[model samples]
Target: MPTPILVIDKLHIGYGHKVVIRDLSLEIREGEFVALLGASGSGKSSVLRTLAGFHSVMSGRIVLEGRDIT
Candidate 1:
C-alpha cells in the first residue's frame, strides 16, 4: 500500500468549550478522492476548516506528506 498524503489522527475539534468533533481519524492517499457527507451542523465544515488551518483542534494531529501540520 502507498503511504497516505494526508493523515488525520485522533482529531478532536470544537468551538470554545463545546466539542463538535471527537476522535476523528482519516487518511487520504495520492490519487485518491474523498468527501465529507453529513447533515447540517454535523461538523463537516469544521473538519474542512480544521484541515485548512482555519480552526484549531482540541487534540490529536494532522499530518501531511510525512510532516505534522497540526
Candidate 2:
C-alpha cells in the first residue's frame, strides 16, 4: 500500500465547551480523491476547517505527509 499523503487520526474539535467533532479519523493517499458528506451541522465542515487549521483541536493529531501538524 502507498503511504498516505494526508491523515487525520483520532481528531477532536470543538468550540468552547461544545464538542462538534470527536474521534474523527481519515486517510488520503496520493492521487486519491475524497469528499466530506453529511448533513448540515453534522461536523462535516468542522472536519475540513480543522484540517485546514481553522480551528483548534481538543485532542488527537493531524498528520500530513507523516508529520504531525496538529
Candidate 3:
C-alpha cells in the first residue's frame, strides 16, 4: 500500500472558549480526491482551517508526509 500524503491525527481544533472540532482524524493518500461534507456550523471549514494552520489546537497531532507538522 502507498503512504498517505496528509494525515490528520486526533486533531482538536477550536477558537477561544469554543471547540469546533474534537479528536477529528482522516487520511488522504497521494493523488486521492476528498471532500468535507456537513451542514452549516458543523466545523467542516474549521477542520480545513486547522489543517492550513489557521486555527489553534487544544491537543493532538497533525502529521503530513510522515512528519509531525502540528
State which candidate has the highest lDDT.
1
The clash count for each model shown is 0, 0, 0
Residue lDDT tens for model 1, 1-70:
9999999999999999999999999999999989899999999999999989999999999999999999
Using all chains and alpha carbons, the TM-scores for the candidates as numbered come to: 0.97, 0.92, 0.88
- Per residue, candidate 2 scores C-alpha lDDT tens digits across 8-56 of 8888899999999889888999999898888889999888788888888
**Residue 42 deviation, candidate 2, in Å?**
0.6
Off by more than 4 A, model 1:
none
Model 1 is weakest, by summed lDDT over 10 consecutive residues, at: 33-42
RMSD of each: 0.5, 0.9, 1.1
Better of 2 and 3 by lDDT: 2
Using TM-score as the measure, which candidate wins?
1
Candidate 1 TM-score over all chains jointly: 0.97
lDDT accuracy of residue 13 in candidate 3 = 77
In candidate 3, position 38 carries an lDDT of 92
For candidate 3, what is the TM-score?
A: 0.88
